[model samples]
Structure formats: C-alpha cells, structure tokens
Target chain A: MARKQGSHSDITGPRVRDAALRLIARHGYAAVSMRQIASEVGIQAGALYNYTPDKQTLLFDLMRGHMADLLAALEAADLQGDSLSRLEGFTRFHIRFHLPRPDQVFVSYMELRNLSDENFAAVEAMRRTYEDALESILRAGEAEGVFAVPDPRITTMALIAMLTGISNWYRAGGRLESDKIEAIYWDMVRRAVTA
Target chain B: MARKQGSHSDITGPRVRDAALRLIARHGYAAVSMRQIASEVGIQAGALYNYTPDKQTLLFDLMRGHMADLLAALEAADLQGDSLSRLEGFTRFHIRFHLPRPDQVFVSYMELRNLSDENFAAVEAMRRTYEDALESILRAGEAEGVFAVPDPRITTMALIAMLTGISNWYRAGGRLESDKIEAIYWDMVRRAVTA
Candidate 1:
C-alpha cells in the first residue's frame, strides 16, 4: 500500500468515479454516455476504460459503493438497547446516509435498469441483504412482544419508501436541513411499524 | 346525432400515444425519438408532427393521459363511507388501474425529467391533487381518532410507495392476479395506518 500510495494512478480512479456518479445522477443512468463522463473528468473518452470497462460497470460500482457505505454507517452507530433503539438507529442512519447524496441515491435506485443481468443480480443481492437485516430487527421486536405488525415485509417496504421518499424531495438549498428531514422521516417509519 | 362517429383521422392520436408509451417504457424517454414512435405506429416520420409537434409534447401527452385516467379512476370509485373506506378504495383502484398499464406507470414515474417545465408542472399538480385526496382521508381518520399517524404527508408518501412498488416488480403472468395483489396491498396499507 505504501509503495503505490499518492501516485497518479491512485487519484485517477476516484476522480473518474466521482465524475461518473455526478453525471449519472443528473442525467440518469441511461442518458449519460462515456464521452460525457470523460469530458467531465478532464480526460479523453478512451481514458475512462482504464478505470472501468463500461458504463454499466461504473453505475454498478457507484451503487455497490453506496450500499456498503450505508451498512457501514448502521454498524458504526452505537445502538445499545431494545428493538426500538435499533429501529430508530436504522431509520436515522438510512435517511442520513442517503439524503446528502441525492445523485447517488437517484443513481442507485433509478440506474438499476441499465446494469447487465449479472451485475444487477449482484447489486440487488447486496440490497436484499440490507433489507433482511431490517427485517430481522422487526422480527426480533415482534418476538420480544414490542412490535405488533401484521406483516413485516409490507412494514419494511413502507418504512423504506417513507425514508427514501425524503431523498427524492430533499434539497440542500431548500428550507429543511438533512437532520430535520431525517427526523421527520424517522418519525413516520417508527409510527408506521411500532407497537 | 349525425356526427356521432369516431375520429378516423389518419393520424390516430391515441394510437400514437400508445406506441410512444411502450417505446419509452422499454427505452427511456430520452432514448426514444419521434421517428421511432412514428415508425412503430406504421407512419412516416414527418407525419408524426401532425399528432405531436415534438417529442416532448408527445411525452407530455402520454403522461397527461395516464394522470387523467388515474384521477378519473379515483373519482369514479365509491367514496361514500368514512375515511378508511375511501383510502381502501383508492389502494384497490390504484393497483387495479395501474397493473394493466405498467408501461404507463413506469413512464409516469420515470419521464418527468423529459417534460418541459409547463407540462412537468401540470403533471405535478395532478399528482398533488391525488395525494391531497389521500391526505384528506388521513385527516378524517385522525379526526375520528382511528388512524395513528405522526404526519399525514409522510404517511401518504409511504402508502403510495408501497402500492406503486407493486408495479415495479409485478409480472402479468405471475401466479397472483391483479385483484389479489390489490387486496394484499390494501391489507398492508390498512394495517399500517389504521389503529
């Protein structure tokens, strides 16, 4: 790691990915082309090939990165209590992680269509893994007699949509800060599923 | 009475819209060109201008038609009872009405970026009107002390997302029928919001 650190190759990869993320977020996954992305990064269109083989790979990379970031945030949060605290932590972490990067969130959700079938399966698997984590929390709450949801699947979808919808509508230049928006979303998700 | 006949104009407006909807649904709005839609409709590219002045207009026309259909479905449903019945009726109607037109549903959710400002504003207004109707139901339920919601606006987004998510994944040839899917969704929405 020490030998290769801070070399020209090291910086190019992240720069290319950042430019691709912004373009894909703004223009949608399908609409952005390699030429557009390379231009944004101050490189020739052919240079992008060095970092990622194709546009689909770039989108897959960004979304995969976001999902891992999300799960990491949840893990880092110190929730040391009952199921409710876990639920609260999950909701807050989700909204907070997603809201700041609307482009990433939009790309992650909207660009799934452009991924190759194999790439898509991998991305969706990671996403489903996160969802299962949330489901387990709900199931544990139910077993502990703290949650009384009729169906965990529906509750989970509803809660996620409630949180993700905030990202669709949340704007940094707008009135509400990200924390307030997260709190508002958390309130709705908690009430919708809480016993 | 003498003029009670169909408009057999060579450029059938509805037919063109249907073709564009399917094309845009398969390829995104930006990928779709007016010539492609005209070709799909079995007409010369130049002739398409008679129906829609431009591609954006065509996109707007399809979306407006979908919104009109949605609102009409909502209005025609029996809302004679309390807020709960009204909300249930909406969920059922939404699933039934949208399932058959998944392409339109996809276009409705995904094509807003393609519309001009005026058309986008019109679509947004129609969407808000529908949401407002749901908000009214939530308000009524809250007044009756039956629904436990922290925020009507947030709850409305969740309910819509939960129901709309069905179209994203539902297949026409699946084991479940549209009615059953609607019923399952109604069950989910009913339990999630109502006490």
Candidate 2:
C-alpha cells in the first residue's frame, strides 16, 4: 500500500507508546492487551499492529527506548571535573531524570521479567552500561585516594539503588524540593564512598 | 457447608497463598486470575473462594501477612548493644532477611500501586513501624555523638532502601556469600552514617 503524506502513523506512534507505558505501568505488561492499548490510544485494535508486530515487541521497544534515552541523556549530561564532582553530578542527574518519570521507572524495573530472554538481555546490557558509568567514577576516586570503596561493583549497585529508590516515595510539592533531596543524597553518597 | 477435618481446604489454603504469591510476583497481581491461582493449587475455581473471598482480600492478606511477619521477625532479631552496634545489627539483618525472600520484596514494593487505598494505608503503617526501628537507631547514634546523620528520617529511608536493594541482584551460590555481601554493605552503611 502506498503511504499518504502526514499519515496517522507518525501522529499515533507516540500516543501508542505513551498509552502503552501508562497502561503497562498501571496494570502490568501481561495483563494489558493490544485492544486495551489501542482503546487507550483511541485507535482500532488492528491498527496497533501497524505500529508494532505484537505486544512483546511493543514492550521491548518501550524498554529499549527508555534505556537508549537514558544513555543518551547521560552522555549529554557532560559529567566532568574531579571524581567527586562527577559523582555528585551523576547523583543529581539520576534523581532529576527518574523522579518525574515514575511510570517509566516503575515499568522499566517491574516489567523486565515479562520481556523475552533476548529483550531482557538487551535491557540488562543497557542497565550495566549505566552502572558502569558510576563504577568508573568510583574507580577513579579510589585511584586518586579520595574514596575507599571496598567493592566498586557493589557500591555502584548500592548507590544506584539508593538514588532510584527516591522515585518510590518522592512527590511534587513535597516538603523537600528536588534540589534539596539531591543535596541530601549527594552528601550520603559522598560519605559512603570517601575515605 | 460443614467443615471436614483434613479436607482440601486445609491442604490447599497454604498452597493457594503460595501459588498466588508466585504467580503475582512473576505476572503481577493485576494479571493473575483466581482460576489460574486455583489451577496452580490443583483445585477447582469455586473452591478457591473457600480460601479467600476475593482477589482483593487475597492480595491484602498477602501484603498484610508479609508486613506482620516482617514486624514479628524484627522483634525476634532483638537487636542490642550500643547505638553503633545496633546500627550494624540492622544493616546486616536487613540484607540477610530480604535476600532469601526476593519474590516477597519485589511484590511488596512493585504491587503497592495495585493495593486498595485502605489496604495501602495499612501496609504503609506497617512499613512505617519497620522504618521507625531503624530511625530509632539513627536517633540514638546521633544523640550519642557516634553518628552524624543530618536527617535521621532521610537516612533511615536511604539505608533501608540500600540494604533492601540487595535482593534485586544477589543470587544464591553467586560470587559472594550472603555473609560477605552483608559485610560489604555494613561497611558502607557504617561509613554513610558515622561521625
């Protein structure tokens, strides 16, 4: 079939992803169906197939997209300066990046089990890449005698988990602003790693 | 119907909760159906209701049970000694306790959104009690000039999040034994709060 100019695909593509992310985050990936996603997008059930082959692919795409965006943002964050400053930057960046995207964060962590083996590996690799960014900072700090981490790998996972945990309880217009939360977490991260 | 001794209900009650937990952890609570849970327990669909009135009650029971068991175990831990020792006790205990129950930890955190408001409040209150135990340690440590926690509440949440996070990646027969992992985490936790 010949494609028309300004086709619905371009317009509906983002809506499909958004609806799928919201629904999957709310009800989980296995329970959500194509019809439900399509309805959420205000499209026909069969039309969803035009965007993705199946629910699995749709899920894989959403996850991969999130990771890809995260990595790209990390690169753009231009984390520079001494190891301490770099670690601080990374801590603040992680909280800011994840706090607003509660749905993405929840779906990314919770729905990994539902991904196919191949998809799971791809997502895991991206996650490892992100963790490596922090691990390198710890390694650098250790070499500089600025930090005394017993295990950089373990510390990497611990810090990431701690920072990401904020998404679970933080809300907008709360007692602490994002910057205040970031500063408090940065202090703990610094103390946890420093000699 | 009159109750029968050693009836299927007696045998199937635990099986139902076990199957429900496993299924809910794997596929999420919103996705698992009563029939599926019953089938997993090798029982008929109608008979499933004999164990629990509905899925909401089943979920509430599972969550409440997890919290109750957690609180009871915390009391049994009988953490003692100076504030610093108590803090170490908590750091190690949290990791050891959660590592063996990854499914429960995962479901408890991930399924909070699926819980009804009343059920969620009950679970939250129980969680607060657990957090309070840790907060008291921090408070005592700070008062004794042993720990320099800027905000005890925030530190409590951060430490608990960090310790509980071990379950996300730790596997039995992995590179590090539970004791080793606990030691590494205790070191970090100690560093994170010490003066």
Best by lDDT: 2
Stretches off by above 4 angstroms in model 1 are A78-80, A173-177, B1-11, B148-150, B173-184, B191-195
What lDDT does candidate 2 reach at residue A71?
97
Q: Candidate 1's error at B63, in angstroms?
A: 1.2
All candidates: CA RMSD in angstroms? 2.8, 2.6
- Candidates in order, TM-scores: namely 0.88, 0.95
Off by over 4 Å in 2: A1-7, B1-10
DockQ of 1: 0.38
| N/CA/C clash count, model 1 | 0
Interface RMSD of each: 2.9, 0.8
Per-candidate local distance difference test: 0.78, 0.92
Per-residue lDDT of model 2, residues B12-99, tens digit only: 8888999999999999998899999999988899989999999999998988999899999889999999999999988877887889
Question: Model 2 residue A134 lDDT?
Answer: 98
